[model samples]
Target: MDLFEKAAILQYRHRRIGDPGRCVGWCSTDSQRLRFDVLCRVGDTSDSQTLATSVSTMCPSSSTKRAGAMVIFHAPDLCRPACCTPFFQMDYVLASGVLSYRCRNALYPYKAIRQMWEAATRGPGFNLLAANVFEASHVLCGQNQHAILAFSRTLDPAAELVTGSVTDDFTLLMRRRAA
Candidate 1:
């Protein structure tokens, strides 16, 4: 698949929710509701641990889930350095009401990250900047989850806007069709 297509699939699989046999729970937003299930295998245990650690360091301990599977909701904001610059922000009503966000850390390529963020806030949902550092990151992460949501654009222009949940794996990109 092309890079954009691959990115979108990766975002969807990573942010997927509902009962996937391994994880199940309830999550809600002001106007929407979701159920999430995380599917993984024995070999993925270490990757799960790393995700837990990264989440813990960035968010409160209670916000982090360490088990092989669990559920949660996440809201996110995509902020730019200047006020006049367009920004992207949205909320992800996961199957579980777990508030999570991700910031566009310096680690990602600037152009790709900006495009991903634009694909989010420009879609449906409320536009609100998060309050705290953790909250901002949570929103940013939610935007990241939209990588798949953005890919859906390739299939149907009228499809509902997409959003994603945070995940540790990048291999999900291998499953998408090239443009």
Candidate 2:
């Protein structure tokens, strides 16, 4: 189908699913086309406040300027074997990265963030690290090491939890010690 046809279908589907459009964020191979279509439907009033509130409650520090739900895509065989489940998963390995707040905002907490990451990684989903290019600085500067160690003690016992410079190439893979 053409871009317009696909957008119309998505809109119809979204409406059928009770998703009011305003509060939904989509990440697809054709992001530009999707965004254009969504914007065209901006005239339709949808209360995104509730979604913003929920997101704020989970991550209180996150900016609510344009808060919305994320819809990720995961193709087969791209994620870890354990992630091959019936849940909606994103391909973190192929993702550019994620953008999150440094501190807990109104919507989420440290525990919640860790749980989400663990859950995503444990299943057939996106790689949180791969989807989050800025995680290195955000975690290191935000002292997320302590949080990580606290939540997953068995993963890194001798973690020093020191402040480090944030680099573009920073990935969670380097935080591990030799086995």
Candidate 3:
């Protein structure tokens, strides 16, 4: 099938699942909250200057913005350029970077990976947290499969995977390296 056909089928499947197009990879609201808590803790936003990538619903940009924090709030369907574009207009002096989730790439493919590299400086790295279930247990599972493959194809080419850990969720702290 072509891209449009694939998109239509995916939309149909989302409608049948009774989910908004943005709700990809999450099984429930509770699980989503749990993941958010983990991400916030891991990313460590105590310093007001810290920059982060967070789920728009889970982490309101307003709260961060109020505190003079720069956060890239990601929704799979909306804000595609913020999530996918390889460059930001300003020079972001990178600190040891924050964590990111790959579920956001379900629709945009590996653009997130490329964007992260472009956003960070040379030494300090960023974390990539992703989990993919291969079988299509439901419509969202197919999106997960797409995410898994996108990571496989794009991650190694973009950054050096410095350290990794896997449980129910997998996290990889990747450093910016010469391409």
TM-score: which candidate is best? 3
Could you give the C-alpha RMSD of every candidate to the true structure, in order shown? 16.1, 17.7, 7.9
* Candidate 1, lDDT over the whole model: 0.26
lDDT of each: 0.26, 0.27, 0.37
Which pairs clash (backbone N, Cα, C closer than 3 Å) in model 3? none
- lDDT string for model 2 (1-179, tens) is 23453354345434535332332222332432322222212121122211111110122112222343232233222112222234633312111122222223422223433333343422111112222343333221222333444543444344222122222221132122324
Per-residue CA lDDT of model 1 for 1-179, tens digit only, reads 23553354336435654434312111223112111122121122222222111111122122224542232222222222111124523211111111222323433323333343243322211111122212333223332334433543453344342223322221111011225
Q: Output the better candidate (2/3) by TM-score.
A: 3
Residue-level lDDT tens digits of model 3 in 34-147 = 444333332334343333443223433233344454544443332222423445432221211122222333443345445644554432223233334234332222223234
Error (Å) of candidate 2 at residue 128 is: 10
Instruction: Write down the TM-score of every candidate.
Output: 0.19, 0.24, 0.44
Best by lDDT: 3
Clashes of each: 30, 27, 0
Rank candidates by TM-score, best first. 3, 2, 1
